[model samples]
Target chain A: MMPVEAFLRQDAEAVRPAPALVKRGWRKLLFGDVASSLLTVLISLCALWAVPRVLDWAVFDAVWRGNGQACFDAGACWAFLGAKWPLILFGIYPPDQQWRPIVVVLAFLAITLWSLPERNWTRATATGWLVVIVSSLLLMGGDTLGLQPVPTGDWGGLPITILLTVLSLTIGFPFGILLALGRRSEDRMMRWLSVGFIEIVRGLPLLTMLFIAAILLPLMLPDGVTFDNLSRALVALTFYSAAYLAEVIRGGLQSLPKGQEEAARALGLGRLATLRFIILPQAIHAVIPPLTNTVVVVVKNTSLVLVVGLFDLLSAGRSALTDPDWPSPYIETYILVGFVYFVICFGISRYSLWLEHKLSAGVQR
Target chain B: MARPSPARESTASASTGWRIAQVAIVLSLVGLFAWLASNTAQNLHSRGIMVGFDFLWRGARFPIAESLLPYDPTDSFGWAFVVGLGNTLYITLLVIVLSTALGVVVGVARRSSHPFASGLSAVFVDTCRNMPIVVQLLFWYAVVAFGLPDTDHASHPLPGVWFTDRGLYFPRLHLDGPLLPGVFVLVVGLGWAWTVRRRDQRRRTETGRSPHAGRKIVAGTLVAAVLVAATTGLRPSLEYATLGRFNYMGGVTLTPEFVAILVGLTVYSTAFAAEIIRGGLDAVPRGQWEAARAIGLSEHQTLRLIVLPQAMRLIIPPMTSQYINIMKNSTLALVVGYPELNFITATTINQTGQALEGVGILMAIFLAISLGASWLMNLYNQKLGLVTR
Candidate 1:
């Protein structure tokens, strides 16, 4: 099948011709790829030229030493953020006990990363989570752990934000599953109640729920029973997260075939046993991606803490902009906040996608 | 008949266990409910707060910015709620229009042959969708709004449109006569097209020739529209907006809240819609298109006749949910202060101090809207479903 020109062309393509200007053979192909690479490099350079300018403004031309007047330059006044960093992070927590928060934050991060790996999905993992929860409570809500008492209001910044997100999900996921199951129940009354609950919760905006939690939840309680503002926020977050999570779980449950449940039932499995052992595993596997997506959404929605006057990352960023010394750094502060949000969200998204592919790989027909 | 007694005995034992389980479940549920109710009552008693609807009729001292109805601060909380409902409807309608239009266009463009168009579609999807809605909203509010010149230095670069920090101001259309008549004519035209389509289908079945039903209906509708327009003498003209020292006049102005919400929703949702449409189109076999052309059908006819009808069946469920999402995500309007249900609920909560009542009303409104949409779509879905054994 080989023609004379094909043979000659193959030989020519393997080695370069003598004349550099002509750019024959491998040289021509190599040159094309090189040209594209060079073009890409040039584009990246142009795009990233602002980075050095930002760096120069942030560090080199920055006022690192100033408190107020010395930051009066055209560059970024990171010194303002520097001064208020602790206040922004820990809010009005007493100055002497700042290390408690820093320690707790480190512990929280360590435990979170430890629990994130799939290999840790065991009963021991649940136990570890409980320990972490107790430790974090003692660390943050300190009077009982031989540490100075720090009020919930004193909690602020990224720690509270993470706490709200993690705690909401921790409680919400189980209750959400129960709600989802109730919604899918054969008993008409139970189904209706669950449906009513989910629909009612889902229909209202989270802000209204937060408003209710802040204003009326206390009023709805017994005379002596008072919930702290942080607890109120937590309750509001749980309710909102649960409603959405219920929907996500419902999606998973619906994806499983009727035959799956039927098969389990035929094998002498009770409804609970079928659901627990067979149906839920397969259904939840199918929905890991969207479930993870819901988590990511929860993370972003944690920014809504600002509505209720909590000092989340976004609120902290806003507060940073308010400092009289560095009013012009609003853009820079917001950009930094946005970058942090994007990194976390994007990481979760990538993980979700990878999980989706892995789970669905052999099942592809 | 004789063997049934042992089977019944065995089944009765199983049924007994089921009864016990049901009893336990109900007992637990009732117990939880009682506990919650008692706790709530106790809390209410303790805080000196009465949870009732009595406050609903009380005068709300707060004023809404952009209510469709006449609402004064002296109005009752219930009256304020009506204003809030109207605003919610208005914003929902506007967002629905913009999002659906943008979604359809982007959905189509995602399947475009042109590399540039496809690339642009991908970029739009990736950028708008990958970014969180809150971040996008904040970006629009902070960067875009602040980057624009102040209202004092607002410009009218276009003939009848003004751009400012407040919002986009465009010329409002003023009709010489009642516009409802025009709408009636449009509805009548649709009816006429339906009748013509039925007749054309009959003709095609009888004659064994392909029906030119689409063309026939379109022509008939156009003729009916023009005839009705002429009869009604409904000539409409634009009244150009005039920018004065303080405010713009003679035009409908859009607030930045509406703009930001609309822009965010449209771009963010269009990406998902694009994926849905692309998936639907790709699901259609190439053989169908080839066979369509083999019958002397043009490219447009092949798409319209052979492709889309099949694709629509696959598209409707997802598309229906997307539409529902548009209604739900309209709540995002609250963040930008677009006077939607959530915003009004916030105001109501602030004004009447009836958190439960305000939230209850909001949930009811959303549920009504959602249920109404699903009911309508369910009917259409049933009709369009494949009738197979």
Candidate 2:
């Protein structure tokens, strides 16, 4: 026979527990959240009401397609954007030869998508630069491809922005790796020179450097030795990005364990061989995330070329808004430009995150 | 036959090679140096431009929008440059303090037990981190300078202050006499409080009683400073911004430029800071917190006395680096015409035609600022590190 206390304890333990939907302290939290949500909705509704009232007078009842004062209403006169999208995107490239930038864009897209596959990546890196060089020369110079020669001054808009980013990264990243290695070297002179160059580049703003290259470099260079404005901007971007990329690569190098280097040495590999065969591969792999971040930063910074009067995307958008036909589409044009930048940056980040997961898979074991 | 010691033989061989390499390196360096110097000299001569520091002390003819110290268009270039440097430091320090505080809070919130707080923090991080800083800067500047209420409508009284596109005009503190004595007294009170708290903590360890030292120190400092202020006879008054015929008067006005820059910098950097803080918090071992609780210390005491002290070493290095980043990013102020160091230097270059000199000075200033920050924080990092060791 069991005692009463034992019976009671057994009874308590015997019943299977029901899972509670809400936690013990959740009521107050839920109530507070609901109240705040309601207030937010009320405020938002008021704003929405006011916005549409204005929009009705400006957009809904306003002229849809017209020139001059015929399109002069309060809301966005987006008709001008429709008219200028081609010119804004293709810039002053000869209308007949507009196919050049279009082909360049298509090639870039194909290469980028194909390179995302691991098997294609090696050839992608080598062939990608070759394609870039060939296509860029075709698009910019035009004489090489039996096309009409279009000076860089005629280049503007989306094509120019993309070209600047690609050229900068392609030139800068390899140089950045060299700088990182030099800075880490035991050789005193190499290390100091590398360090000095990296610091000087990193310390100045890209805008300041771009400004100097635009205004001052011209004076420094003798007549007929002058580089194109686009070339100077590309140079500034490359140097600036290389300094930042070197720092990121240095982070990757520092993250590597001493054992890796020691093991390479034990294998009787010389300094160059060890760096090429063993060290760099692992360091670069470890630094993939920061390298992606640097790329994104570089992409955003391409807009600064606008300050030096290059007609990049931002400048293109600004140009679209300035048309006497659509004087008030500034907000809409800016939003569109912002959307483009957001899409590119967000895509890169997602891809990098995916790569991180893929690479980190076996480390746990 | 003669035999040499191993050390002497090795030294002889090493010295021979070393001397050859040294001579080659030196010769190369000297050659390179001579080439660069002569080329620069020849280039300058061809351009008919004489290079010297004489322009720095010479009177400058330029109008600057904002200067921290007294300056005019007639002021020397050196004076103008100094004022710009001071302004840069001021903005950097202010941004660092504000962003750090906001970042710590957001970081802590991200790790909160509550779901809403964590979700909010995650959204903030994603939105701010992914967006281009330049776009954000332009957006904020437009919202403030163009989108906000016009200056005409802003004169309507709203809680004793006027808010407008021009600025937030509020009552400014007016002092008839120097408040230095009051400040000195307050500082002394703080110092005394620290000493007393340390003494009380030591006494508690020996005597085995609850110290309540923190409360005692707070009480002592508050009492001491308030009493000193009362006795010091400091005449303080309020000067509210007045609506005038032409402009708002009698107030310390904040320009829209300052507001936009502050907002942009704070919002951008805080997202990064939040990530770093969350990382620091995660790096602390869970066992430490459990151990503190096991000893019967309350949660607050455990957090303050155990978790935070241990986590600080990890927290500080990233935090200081973020501070340095924000300092550099403040140069973005030039985009909006904020007369910061870069903007001033840009103007100087335009006027002086000393592009190389101006750029060199700007780079040097930034490098010094970054290195100085790293050095100062390294001292604290060392101190915190010793605690764990």
Put down candidate 2 lDDT per residue, A80-195, tens digits, no spaces.
66667767676767778888878776777777777765566595477876867676767667877677888888877778878888889889999899899879976576689789
- Decoy 2 TM-score against native: 0.83
lDDT of 1 at B329: 66
lDDT of 2 at A271: 60
Second chain TM-score per prediction?
Answer: 0.84, 0.85
**Number of the top TM-score candidate:** 2
Per-candidate TM-score, first chain only? 0.79, 0.85
Q: Following a full C-alpha superposition, what root-mean-square deviation does model 2 have from the true structure?
A: 5.8
Q: Write the per-residue lDDT of candidate 1 for residues B1-389, one digit (tens) a residue.
A: 35543233342355777778778988998987787678767665664667788887888888677766888988888787788778767766776676667766777767754443466677677666655565566666654465445677777778887778777788988778656666777787788778877888888889977667667667777777767776788787898777677877668887767677767776677777777877888889999999999989998999898998888888888888777776766666676677766777787776555666676777677778777777788899898897889
Give the C-alpha miss distance for residue B20 in model 1, angstroms: 5.2
Across residues A1-365, which tens digit of lDDT does each residue of candidate 1 receive?
77777646444346656766763453333234654446445545765886787688777887766666776544666677667778666666677888877876787777767766667767887887778777777888788987888888777777777788889998998989988988887767668878887877765556666766777676556566888777888898898788889899999999888999889988999878998999888887788789889888788778776767787777766766676655445545665666667777777777888878876884796
Give iRMSD, candidate 2: 3.9
Model 1 alpha-carbon drift over 4 Å, by segment: A1-120, A124-126, A144-149, A243-283, A328-335, A363-365, B1-28, B31-59, B143-145, B176-238, B285-298
Q: Score candidate 2 by lDDT.
A: 0.76
CAPRI class assigned to model 1: incorrect
